[model samples]
Target: SHFIVGLTGGIGSGKTTVANLFAEQGIDLIDADIVAREVVEPGSEGLAAIVEHFGEHVLQSDGQLDRSALRECIFSQPKQRLWLNECLHPLIRKRMLELIKQSTSAYAVLVVPLLFENGLDSLVDRTLVVDISPELQIKRTQDRDGVDKGQIENIIRSQMPRQQRLDKTDDIIDNQGEIQEIEQTVFALHKQYLSLSKAVLS
Candidate 1:
């Protein structure tokens, strides 16, 4: 079997940048966000199911999911959010598994933000934690997400804590430095994963 590395980090932690480094190394990347969107495409089974449960209000005039409107509804209502997650997660997970099975690379990278929170670590051979300080994470979240202090704090509180994430990771990428430093760490880890994959195959 090909190596499958689960890449995770808290909101605003540089997991996407690390995934890009893996892309540069020609590793297959299975991004859960991308899969989530795909499964909900207009007229898809996932979209149909969502509409059946949530009604047409969740869709745009053009019949696509009105993500902004949906986000507002979910963020304000926990029951709605959980119902939506229940409707979409299994569909997304099924599609992601199919894609992972079809990957042809020596190893595949699964970029999941909630890898530990969702217990998705079981799907991979190793876990890579992209680490950053809580202060840095808060600053980055506010700047990048255009969120307020209270909203950022709430989102952080909902996720698995940094300490718990660090405790479960098989490898760590410290991302509290310059972009070049992050790239260097990712390149080194890429080489290490490749070597390990080759040895296992041999």
Candidate 2:
């Protein structure tokens, strides 16, 4: 397997943007969020299991998962949230690993937003945390999603604390600056990862 870097960040910390920059350098990306969605698409067993447990109301008229409705239900009910995670986490992990094995790049980025919290760090050779101030995270999330500040705060509280996430990471990208700055940081990491991957192979 290629060397794996687990990339994570708090909500609205521009993780996807950073991932895109790495992708531009020809690194493969196995994104947990994307695989999470895939596991629950219309004909998938994941969606079928959800409908079985949470009922068909979790589905839209087109038979797709009603993500907003499911999100609201889970957030308001702790038991429901637990049950949903129990159902989805294994499926997500399975798919993520399968994709990672298919990568042919010098190194691959495994983008898991809950990398630390979910114990996904074990899957990677190194960890990268994209960091921003808490205030910036709150503002960016609210502005991007049009959600209430309270909701954004709650989501942040649910993840690993900011400093702890940084402390555990093998690399950190400070994402509070301009787009050009972030790009330059990612470019440097790309080269570093290439070297690290070769070292691992040797």
Candidate 3:
């Protein structure tokens, strides 16, 4: 089996920043969000199935999946959400596994925003949760995405409770500090994961 470390955080938790710092240390990143998008790109089976079930309105004029439209569709219909997940999760997981297999780093970082929600921890040897304050999460998400506070709060509500996520994580990276400090912590974790990977691989 491959040595995999899962990095997870809620929206606006700066997971990308922390992941980049590890990438700088030669770690490969298998980002679930990116894989999710890739699986639904134009002409993919995933997209075709989506269109078949949801109709063409889920796609933009250029034929790409209209993320906002799909989101709205699922948001208004819980059954649609479950159906879409059933349609897409297997494709996403298959692609993610392919990416992980291609990774040649000491250990790959499987960065997922819904690591716990999607039960992705089973794919990794260890899990890292990036923790941040709710107030900061709202502010950062609003600044980065131009999303309103109510929408951001809704996203937060949709995720596992902060404490529950923490209880399940093997490692916790605090994103409440300065970027310099966070980078330093990432470097430290990189070293730790490298050693841990060695132990596991040996």
Better by TM-score, candidate 2 or 1 = 2
TM-scores for every candidate against the unseen true structure:
0.89, 0.91, 0.94
lDDT of 1 by residue, 1-202 (tens): 3778999999899999889989988999999989989999997999898788778898999999998877877887989989988888888788878989899888899999999887788888899999998889889888888878888778788899999999999999999988898887888888888888888788
1 or 3: which has the higher TM-score? Answer: 3
lDDT (10s digit) by residue, model 2, range 1-202: 4799999999999999999999999889888978989999999989999999888899999999999888877887989999999998889888888888898999999999999998989989999999999999999988888999998999999899999999899999999988788888899999999999999999
What lDDT, from 0 to 1, does candidate 3 have?
A: 0.91
Cα RMSD, each candidate: 2.1, 1.8, 1.6
Model 1 per-residue lDDT at 140: 87
* Model 3 alpha-carbon miss at residue 9, Å: 1.2
The true-structure Cα RMSD of candidate 3 reads 1.6
TM-score of 1: 0.89
User: Whole-model lDDT, candidate 2?
Assistant: 0.92
| Ordered list by lDDT, greatest first | 2, 3, 1
- Score each candidate by Cα lDDT: 0.88, 0.92, 0.91
